[model samples]
Target: MRSLAGLAALVAAASVFLYLLSTHLPPGPTRGPPGSAEEEEVEEDGGVQEYRLKFPSDLDELRELAEMLKFYNREHHGYVLLLFCSAYLYKQSFAIPGSSFLNMLAGAIFGPWEGLALACLLTTVGSTFCFLLSSAFGKQHVVQRFPEKVALLQRKVEENRSSLFFFLLFLRFFPMTPNWFLNITCPVLNIPMPIFFSSVFIGLIPYNFICVRTGSMLSEISSLDDIFSWGTLAQLLAIALMALLPGALIKRYGEAHLKVDGVDSNGPSRAEVKPVRERW
Candidate 1:
């Protein structure tokens, strides 16, 4: 109950912060010149609605919101940036889904290079915040709620302990991995904070780059399908495989050197190995 209450309070605080930020923004269509293609598209889609700060769920809504924010970005650049950072961090810290939309939005507003940099930085920082929150308030609840999952992840983490950073990189590279789960459970698995932070920062670059780049061309994209097409999936899979190479080599080396009937041939005995395994 205490954990839940703390989580709720944090969420409420974040919501209030967003509300305050939203209030500071001037009304929609405040700066852009008239009848441009961007303006025409926005007008055809029922004109700029009042700027309400929230997550955009689909392409049309994303386009509308992007257009609205772009208009605001012209005159209130600092506030727009702050609002984007705050919203990105809020979702990231809480493990909320739909960051792809925001990543693209960043691209639409900030352009490709800037948006990519921003996305990568915010993703790392936000995920780290989530890790810290989970460390402080979630370990007990996670273990209790998902005992089997916890045990499985604990075993996997131990198996990759020798090359844990590379293993984490592979997970981050693989698009299918549940990153939120990783963030929440990593502390419970005893992963180091430096490794966690570094992995998240370095590992998510490709994904963030893709989203930001697509966002840079937000005007051209038709749907999320355009972002995660077959070619993109292949690229992500290949990157994930490359990230796994170091870890696989480490595993193979350990097995060759240490696995002689489940004990090192010239070193530790079974009894000694027990202590080493426990030490992990």
Candidate 2:
């Protein structure tokens, strides 16, 4: 059993390596050549195939890049090329923890609603890709390293292998579940791409909406940039605390009545807890 588990881990790792090797495009968002590119894909596949972002090699600085795009957009009718490149980079550069910066930039460049929408779309797509890659290569080792967290997410997924949308929704809505970890683990567990996508479709909308809309207001808004602002930080903390509420309640309710698993009927069982579906 251990051997088989090891083999599965090896295979998953190999799959991720292959995926990394297979892509040339910079990850998040890159520009498309407007109508012609769209037409080519439409003509070939009857529907356009969406590309997974890999990462940009050229621009080391975002502000400079944004300024260039701003200039081009002003010169032309719009900045579709910039949109494409930005999206491509955002999606491909999975290592960066990019929300606050991206939101601010989007607001500065794109205004509120559209800027927000773009952020949400870019994030969802990028996040999904990361999930796939991580699940393919790192989930096995990830599970080994963080068994508790892995089990928590596994139960969440097990309930919805046939319903990824529900699973994604559950994970997204529930602040307790680790969204990043789940993304990587889902593929390794063989949740179909379509199903994985269904989860994204339903799950990401609300948070996306919130962040993007808030960002869109950036052009008109002027506030401090404290990472730990009072109001917003308090709200975030509240949400985190709210998720822990259930466990707290359960513990308080059963504190005195809890029994040892290995105890015989007459007394406390001392069976070694070799990990058996303990929920947090």
| Clash number by candidate, in order | 0, 30
- Give one digit per residue, the lDDT tens place, for model 1 in 156-179: 567778878876776676533378
Overall lDDT per candidate, in order of appearance: 0.75, 0.49
- Residue 102 error, candidate 2, Å: 1.3
The stretch of ten residues in a row with the least summed lDDT in candidate 2 is: 259-268
lDDT (tens digit, per residue) of candidate 2 on 97-128: 44545554564457656666666666667667
- Candidate 1 — worst ten consecutive residues by lDDT sum? 259-268
Q: Provide TM-scores for the models.
A: 0.74, 0.49
Deviating ranges (above 4 Å) for candidate 2? 1-73, 76-95, 159-164, 222-280
Error (Å) of candidate 2 at residue 253 is: 24
Q: Which stretches of model 1 miss by more than 4 angstroms?
A: 27-32, 36-50, 220-280
Q: Which candidate comes out best when scored by TM-score?
A: 1
lDDT of 2 at 154: 50
Candidate 2 similarity to native, TM-score: 0.49
